[model samples]
Target: MLEELEDLFESSTIRPTFSYVHIILALYIFEKHPEGIGRYRLKENLLIGSGTARSLINKLSEIVDFIEVSGNNKRRGHVLTDKGLRFLKMLKKKIPLLEEGNTKALEEIIIQDKKLNAYICLVKNSADKLNSGIEQRDAAIKVNGSGATCLIFDGNDLKYPKSPNIQNNQVKIGYDLQKYFKLKATEHNTELDKDDVIIVGLGDTSERARLATLNSALTLIE
Candidate 1:
């Protein structure tokens, strides 16, 4: 299903700077702002160029009919259609949660000169897909992320899939994540299950961090 979403962004003549995560975020933005948002505001939220934002909306409107324009050029805005709502529902089933995180909790693991914005996402039932966590990190990096960390919840605690020796710090990281992320019993009304994967994406800006996090999470989605 995600691949189908990716297909919507694929082009033969030119490559798109934005990704499917951007599309998902755009839908989320519209859902949050029912009054609708203009292309410039959406572009600021997405941290992309005006042309790219226009292209993203054009493709979504013409190809999938998932969105419709509300106002004219001076204050043109967009709102999702019924089909887009259904599509977002489907995505939620796989990726139940996505949120910003406090990087202070991650300082021990991700040491850097500059402070970074982090976005965390919970991908359901995908722990078995992880090995050394390199795959998830690489996915985030490909999308211009500073880096990413992958952890798995084993019904009791969240731990790095490959690093078990640092149990003490791992426990602290997990606790801080749960505390700061303020995870719900079920974000989409789906309970947190054992073997659920958690991905933290780091970037210089919130938009980049979010896209990076979602990109990392998608690698674990089946």
Candidate 2:
């Protein structure tokens, strides 16, 4: 399969950057249509430039075992090998660990730096007592298409949105992240279970939501 993929890449023209986003997106495209999807279709669905699509396909050839088969009208398309399926499953578990490590590293910088610490202080009071674990406490941040954000701790049907901006400033549907963070702490000294995962939403406004999410995340750190 790898040799076959190399031959295909050698025959193709477009090339893209090394992006996990593209790889994941391609996997998603392949998953949605089990029969297989064409290169043109991937480019169209992903809306990345031609070079990016080529690069993405090239990278996938290296990491995932995929193959070309007859798509609609006998056009060439791709599908996941069994190896690819297992790789994605392994990635699902490891991605969160990677994110946590990075988030913690950033948290350290925020706490140790004077300016960052002061910035966090500004909104800490606003996000008090706002956290409630979803059915499961182990979820990483999930956002949905309607702009809803949640850390689902229960059996609750949390629609994890495909992509969430999550920029401490953007507001999805109507989630009030700033106020949600303030809800975590009733009094300054109180401590909740370190395992607790709080969920926030995008509210009616952006500035307020951003402030709240940023503050709420800080409160969690504190």
Candidate 3:
């Protein structure tokens, strides 16, 4: 029993590097907008700050040929190359599994407004279908399966309860969302965060799209 306890403690002690989340988000963003030119807009839409979003783009540029910046630096954006797509396809084969600590972190960052519980439900349900073979017909279906819910508060329609808030000096929540959904960064969009919250139907369309692409890519691998 002592040995088992030691092993458990050792396993729990392993902290994930920020690069893991960054790479995952980069892949997702690349997949959704292979063109890459509209990354700035994508960042805002996804509720990610300009700095964090740019860093992810820069890191991805190193690994794959898909990322390209505009010439003047006046208008910055990214475009995915064939190689990038292939890389994302490869990543699709390995589904990401979040530990209990990660889940707790997610809970803390998410705004616990009126829609908090619904968002949790959506996440839980959608996670169930992560490994399911069926193609998701729509965002609503996907959210239901993932056990997450959307909430419209302060005029911002948060697709999932997970906010892009920073915690424990970790990567932003948007980056984590990209990993959980297994898509490139620009795929998902964000509205405004508001106070008058209401539990809306599941509506993570972009996230669903990313998952679908990942699923399709995984199938091609085997």
Candidate 4:
């Protein structure tokens, strides 16, 4: 655990004295970036000299699950294997590690300290409200002065009732929308907070496109 923690803190652009820390961080990042980060990117980000990086990577390939993937322009790069995945899981502990001076850390603080409940609802027609300078709307079925209602995808209303922990965790959904909406590049533009219920991808009325909207709602509500 300490080795993983130490690797997390090493500057991505600086070469630490220890080469093993570089390998540890690189593997974790490869797991996160499955498409394979480019060789130049790895060199620039991991700060390993070309010759040493090649030799060390070859050595690593002998003992662990490592592969190279080529992308457009045909530059091949490193990614981890199923064996590496199992190894990472063995190394990883259940405890969450919060990074300082970042939004995720701030979010962790909100969940751990402030006891706030955040819910996101995929909404249409909210733009009109925003354009008219009505930024906040309550959960109701209509665009009334007091409240509004909308359909949620996963067999639930887009209503976050007033209760501690939102009916004790029944109201919360944990679908990883980032992975689900991967092909929709524009869907990822929103700024995320730890407790933020981000409702985005508004104004598209196509049936399938709207299904994606429903997916966002369902993912959160399920």
Best by TM-score: 1
Q: Using lDDT, give the best candidate's number.
A: 1
What candidate 2 gets wrong by more than 4 Å, as runs, is 1-18, 62-74, 92-222
- Candidate 4 clashing pairs? 140-148, 140-149, 141-149
Prediction 3 TM-score vs. true: 0.34
- Return the candidate ranking by TM-score, descending: 1, 2, 4, 3
Which of the two candidates, 1 or 3, achieves a greater lDDT against the reference? Answer: 1
lDDT of 3 by residue, 16-83 (tens): 22223334445566566544455576565344567656655654565335466644352656666566
TM-score of 4: 0.35
Q: Which ten residues in a row have the lowest lDDT in candidate 3?
A: 1-10
Give the per-residue lDDT digits (tens) of candidate 2, residues 37-139: 7677777655456766766665565544553343434355677667666655544332211111122222322233222211112112222233432311122
Pairs clashing within candidate 1? none
TM-score of each prediction = 0.83, 0.37, 0.34, 0.35
Residue 82, candidate 2: alpha-carbon lDDT? 71
Q: Work out how many backbone clashes candidate 1 has.
A: 0
Off by over 4 Å in 3: 1-19, 63-66, 69-76, 95-222
What local lDDT score does residue 152 receive in model 1, on the 0 to 100 scale? 77
Give, for candidate 1, the lowest lDDT window spanning 10 residues.
Answer: 179-188
Candidate 4 lDDT over residue span 52-85, tens digit each: 5665455445534354543432355667767667
